[model samples]
Structure formats: structure tokens, C-alpha cells
Target: MPPSLLLQHAPCARPTAKRTASLFSAAVLASKDGGGARPPRPRPRGKPRFSRQSAIRKSFQQEQVVFSTPVSPDPTVAVIGGGASGLACASALAARGVRSVVFDTGMHGLGGRMATRAVDDERQLVFDHAAQFFTASDERFQKLVEEWVERGLVREWRGSIGELEAGGHFRPIHSSTPRYIGVNGMRPLADAMLPENDLIKVIRPSWISKLEPFNGLWRLFENEKPRGQYDAIVIAHNGKCANRLLSTSGLPQLTKQMKRLELSSVWALLAAFEGPFPIPHNNSYGTFEGAFVRGVDSLSWMANNTRKLFPFETDRPECWTFFSTASYGRRNKVPQENIPNATAEKVQREMLGGVELALGLSKGSLQLPFYTRVQLWGAALPMNTPGVPCIFDPQGRAGICGDWLTGSSIEAAVLSGISLGDHVADYFASCGERPEEFAIGLDDSLNRVEGHDIGQFPGLDSSQKPQVAEAQLTATI
Candidate 1:
């Protein structure tokens, strides 16, 4: 039998595109035929028949503009995160001939919430504590995911997934969209996205406490020590640390937008069991790889990490991850670095019991895991978004990108980072010249961008909508 998990209540403590243009060809053919009779009309004086437009519209500038520049140009960027967004941004910039230095506080590795933890005990249990799997709805992102799949960084997760209700009713989620996961864990996907050149330098386990502007360049500092100076800065992170770093960076508008971002907390519990769960199943259903738990106060999600990574093997230790609802996290929040043992035990007990209840198992009926741990995601997911692809402050030479700017997913983070990186590269190539098209997420009156379901979550109520005031449109410059 597995070791019993101890429980005790103690004192509180301590985170699509479309195209047109076929009819014109048919009209040209009909004009030249004998049935049309008259000769084709002469072209207008000094006007070519198919002259393409030179000026780009402000709304479509980011997608349409392409500039050529050599790699390792004069301008260097400082990317302040090594997660999906930051690495993707660095990769995109490197492709455009710009150099970038990425700084992250991840001790184990990059990939922020795309995290995985392995218990070093003899069992050697592995768990993807944060993001389980991701799907690509945009064609641009689908192409990138396909590339990762071909390179062995990612593969399709064909395991069973569904919604687990509080009454122990399970409804399998069926969708045509393909779900992808990293070969080992979610972190390797970000590792593979990184470019293989020296133009993009990565510095990990480094916390950037502040940013100081000197000689028209941003100098980063870890506490009092100066890290380096760069021509531009890309803030690929958010939450309290980010707010503190930019509180006095002299970029008032950028700071204001950062402050407006609302983030939520969550609790993830990782448990390693001896065997498969006792839930009954049939030939039509394989082991559950993931689920979005509904109507449960204490838990929101659960994933079978062992099945997800090694579906064919049954001899390995069974690993599972349970995610608490945002509200439950709020009620039991504590500092991640210094979680009291009492608090940890309490959370572990409550979450495990919650899981048992969801599975309709009697209280304490399930076998205890050989190992267990609890983690607090102080700023887990974004509660609101600016509904933009990315944010860039051209004048201050600072930009921001993450899942918050677009949607809460790995794909959103990558796309946001790539967009900001490409725009900054273009700005540098043009020698500090930019049109209004480069200014995004700056106008207070800007309409929310489409395709993102901001402030919408399974457990979020309508009253929880982000309270951002709509203002008159004003020039960012």
C-alpha cells in the first residue's frame, strides 16, 4: 500500500484569413474573345493596370509591413522573460537580424507556466504542473506547431479528456482540433522554439529588479548590480514583480497599462500514485489524460501526466496533477517561496479530498500517493486583456507582450512575443523612425480586438468583468 498523506488544520502562512480575386481573370479572358467584339480599352495615361498600394493602413500595418535587415545589427533588445512569449520574441527578432538578451528567473528552466517537476525519489515521478496541452486555432500558429511536431519537440496528445462534474458524471470532450504537448514536458516546447544562434543570448535564474535609462539605452539591474544596457526593452512578464520594476521606469503610459492588467492566482497539487485511478471505464475510453472539472469548489482541473507522456507503459509510477479553482486559491493564498508546512499540509489534504469527492470515492477511500506537494501560482492566469496582439511604446523604446495581451494560452504568448519582436526589429532597422501604425494598446478608447474572450472563464462571474473605463481616442505620440 502507498504511504498515507498526513492532514492537519494549522495556522495560515505565505502563487483566419480569406482571399479573393478570381473574377478579374475571367473578365480579362472575356474581353479578348470574339464574342466581346470591341478592342480592349487603352490603359489610363501614366497609370499601370495593376499598381499595388504603397502606403499601409494603420490597422493592418503590423501584419503587412516587412523590412530587410542584416542579423546582429546595431540595436540590441533586452527580453525580460524566458517563457514562451520571451523566447518566441527573441527568436523572431533574431530572424530579422536583431540581437536580444533574455533574462528569466526560472531556476529549473525556462517556459514559465509551461512547467514540469520531477520527484527525485526512486519512483521518479514527473508532473506537468501548469499547462497540460494546447491547441492552435490560428493558421499561422498551426504552421509553427507543425514545425515543432516534425522536429520531435511536440506530439499530439491522443488520450481521453472530458469535463468531470461534481456529481461524478463525466462527459467526454470531443473536438476536431488537435491537442499538442511537448515530447518530454511542456518546457521543452519553449526550449525548441529558441533559435540556435548566438544573436539571442539567454540568462536564466536571474531576477531583474529594476530598469534604468542611460544614454538613450535601457540598463537592467538585478538589485544594485548593473546587468547590461540595450537599445530597446521588451517586458515579457507581468504581476507584482513587473509592476515594481516599472513603477519608476519613467514610462508612465506603459506603466499604467501594466497596472491595468488583472491577474488571478491558482493552486496546483502534484501527487504520485502506485497505480491507475479506480474510476470504471470501458473499451471506448482510454485513460483520462486531462479534464476540466466543473461544479467543484476546490478543484478546476486534473491531468494524468504519466498517461500523457507515456500512454503505452503501465509499469511506471502513475502521476497526476490537480489545479484548484481561482476562488479556492484566493481563499488559501500564501507566498510561494515561504509556504508554511502547516498550510501546505492543509491545502494538500483539502485538494486530495476534493479529488476523491469528484471521483465519487468515499472520504479517504483512495490510496495515498508515495509523494505529494503543493504550489501557489501567485499570478497564474490573466483575468483581463487589452485585446491586442501586443503592446509597444515607440517613444520610450519599451514594449510588453505575454498571454495577457492576447489570450490566456501558450499560443497567445508565442504570438504576442513574435509580434512585438518583429515590430521592434522594424523600428530599429528604420533608424528610430516609425509611423502611427507601430503604436498599439496605447489609446484608452481603443476598441477591444476580436477573437479573444477576455474576462471569460469557466468559474468567473459576470460581475467580475474588468472595470476599465472607455476614454476618448487620443494620439499616443
Candidate 2:
């Protein structure tokens, strides 16, 4: 009989050499015992006639077994600023398969100090008012900048800047390498680093009021409401905001150290004119020691932004940015509305005088259409003092990384992010779990009592009680 017929007749059957031999012996023994022909040992109870068919079916079933691949978990990080520092942090985390959320109070845009303005008219124009130019000082940043240049997002500005002395003398300072600017505007650099989806969620018009440790997670509050939680937080803003956040959290060591940081302010004046002012190419930094104002230039830093400038708007004429002196920045304590008229008049007079000296142009010889606006940067740059640690890892888990932590430059910000990121990655490797990395100190202990002001922000309602089930059990025992 065929194996298929035999299997159909008896679902449970075995085909083995020992069993076949035993069945043959049993048949012979039965034949001798019985009077007539042996019963053939009852057909060996249900052995298949063809054994190969059973092996093929077993092999087929084995081949059909399914296997699953495991997926890695995504890490959560919170970036406090949307400026260059924060953007670089988010980008680095995203590249490592981590998700980051960037929060910025700056007007719905990415750039913090690297700001630009949009001019409205029959033909629109975008001009960069802040961060007049940037240079790459590190290999990592330099390589990234080269890539940006190749993509046409940035281009080199080639010219000699004439430095103005405090005594009204102007001298030219030569820069070997060209200064680079964004092709369209400075904000594109920040925009390019953000992820498309929730991997990087940018929250604009939302300011983080306070941060506290809640149930082993860092909870961030915005406007007294729980915004979100993060495994790690990167404060990329200026020293003032950083100091405020650290102090409000009640971290004594960080608070005490952050008090020493001092940030300088910058007041910027933006203007647009139809005709080009007579000045040397890349004319910048004219000094006036005795006068109220210091530096003056017609085209302080100008490019035929319409054509030569890669990232600038092509529909507009040459774009220029005039920088205010540090003295002017300190004196201008009033609002922005009152700054433009005085700044423009003073700068125009200085530029006209310089033009007459350079190109023999009288005051009325230049006919130009101009627009002026001023910006006051409360914390433009951070003072990098010696003996200051770039990162403060007092609690090991709690760390500070930003431009203020290192040198006050874009490169320093990037380096700070990279350094902190490595520290965080190494920290996870050392600890089996998150809590193991941070020892709960007596000073860091919570009140754990009900209706207490535990970890609540100032002026916020403290109705919610602390979840102390673990503490309650310890007290009961």
C-alpha cells in the first residue's frame, strides 16, 4: 500500500527498522503458535509502507517556521532653544535614532541671534540683520560648512574690511579666507537640521517656565501646564535664561555657579538704500574714540544680494547690515521704536564723510532709498572666563551644555553639544538602568508630604499631592 493511503487509514503511525524487525519476529512467532497462516502481526499496528513521504512533510513544516526581527527603542531628548546650538543637538540625536523636541520662544522662527528681516513691497526682499558673518574654526564644523556651501546654502564674501579707530582714522584689515553667508537667509541653517516628523517637534511661542524631577522623569512645564517629559534636557539658550531655569529648579551648586556669568547686549540697526553708498568693498569697522558713535560705513557689509549672494532674495538690490558699537548698545536702554531715526542720521553723516574722502562725493551727490530698524539683544554673547568648567556634571545625570559653557561662538556650541551627547551615551552604558546613574542625595530629597510646595513652579496652583507610595511603605515598616 502507498504511504499516503496508509497515513489516511491510520493518522498515528511510526516507521522504524527496530519496529519492523520486531513485527517480523512477532509474525513468525504467531504463525508457529497459530494453527493456520500467521495474522502478519496485525500489520504492525499502523506502520507506514513508504517512510520517505513522512520525512518530506516534516521537512516542509520546519521550513514554514516564521522568525521576527527586534526593533530598537527611541530615546527622548528635550532641546531648550531653536538656535544653532539646539538645532545641532537635535540633528545629532536624530541621526542616532533618537527623538528630540525643540522649544523656542523666538517668534515662530528657528534662528535666535542669526536673524533676518522680510521687506514688503511690489518686490519683496529678505535681509540678514544679525550674525553678519560666520567662520568655521573646527574640522567638524568646517566639513559641515563645506557641504552647506556645495548645496548652495552658503557662499563666501570676499573683501577687505576697513577698521575705524576711536580717533576717526580708518585702516584696512585683510582677511585671507572669505566670510560665508547663507544663500537665502541665516535661518536656513537651523531649518535644515530639523527632522520632518515627530522625531523633532518644534514648539514656537511656547516658553518653558520650569523643570522638575517627577517620578524618575524630568517634567517640563509651559505656562503652568505640563508640556512634556524628557530623558535628557539640553539648555541651549543664553546665560540669562539658563541661569533662571537652573536657579528656579533649586539646584544649589548650579545656581551659585551660574550667578557669575555675565552676558553683553547688542543693538542692531538695519537699513536699505536704492543707490550704493561710496565705500571700499566690505567696508566695516570705522572707529570714533571721542564721538558718541564709533564704527560707520555706507555698505557696512554689502552684497549684490539679488545676484551675487546665493541665499539672498534675487528681486532686491544690494543688501547691507550695520553693526552698532558696544557703547551705543549699552546706552540705548529705551525701546526699539526710538532707535532708528537717530542711528540712521548719525550713520548717514559718517558714511557721507567717508564717501567724500574715498570718492569725492558731496552730501547730496548720493540719491538712495533707505529703510532702518534696530534690535536690542539683551544677552548677545557670553563671557568665557578662565577656570570655568564647560560642563557641570555634579549629579552626573544633570549636566549643562551651551555656548556659555564653552567659548562664545557657534563652534563652541556645536562642540558642547557633541561633548554632552557623548557623556550621556557613556552614562547609559555604565548604568544598567536610568536611576542607577543618579544617587538620591539627602540634599536632593523631596518633602514627600501632602499639600506641600514640592517641585511646583512659583505662582502655580499646588493642589496636586506628591505620589509617595514607596515612601509611605518605608514609613509604615
Model 2, stretches more than 4 Å misplaced? 1-74, 165-170, 195-198, 280-315, 335-369, 386-396, 432-477
Question: Which stretches of model 1 miss by more than 4 angstroms?
Answer: 1-73, 280-286, 435-437, 444-477
Query: Residue 272 in candidate 1 has what lDDT?
Result: 90
Residue 234 of model 2 has an lDDT of 68
For candidate 2, lDDT tens digit of each residue in 1-477? Answer: 001111111111122323323432333211122221222122223522322211112221121111111111223567788777677666655444345677888784886765667777655555665654566666666777787787788777554333343323455434455556677777677676554434456788678888664323356788667676555566767556677787655344445545655544454445566654444333344321111112332222222333334333443554544444333444553444355666646654544443344333454665554665545565654432322223433232355556555444455555566555445444433332443443222122112222110111112122233222211100000
What are the per-residue Cα lDDT tens digits for candidate 1 across 1-477?
001111111111000000001221222221122212123433236522211312212231121222211212245678999888898888787665555788999999988878888777776688888777777776667778888887888998878877676656676766667777888888777778776655567888899997765444566788866686566789999999998888867666677788887666777889998878877432335456776676677777788899899887788988998888767777898888899999999999999888887776788888999888888888876765777888887666788989778657787887898788778866665555443556778654323322211111222222222333110000000
Q: Which candidate number would show the highest lDDT if scored against the true structure?
A: 1
lDDT of 1 at 106: 94
Q: What is the C-alpha local distance difference test score of candidate 1?
A: 0.67
Candidate no. 2 TM-score: 0.62
In candidate 1, position 127 carries an lDDT of: 88
Error of 2 at 33 (Å): 81
Per-model CA lDDT versus the true structure = 0.67, 0.46
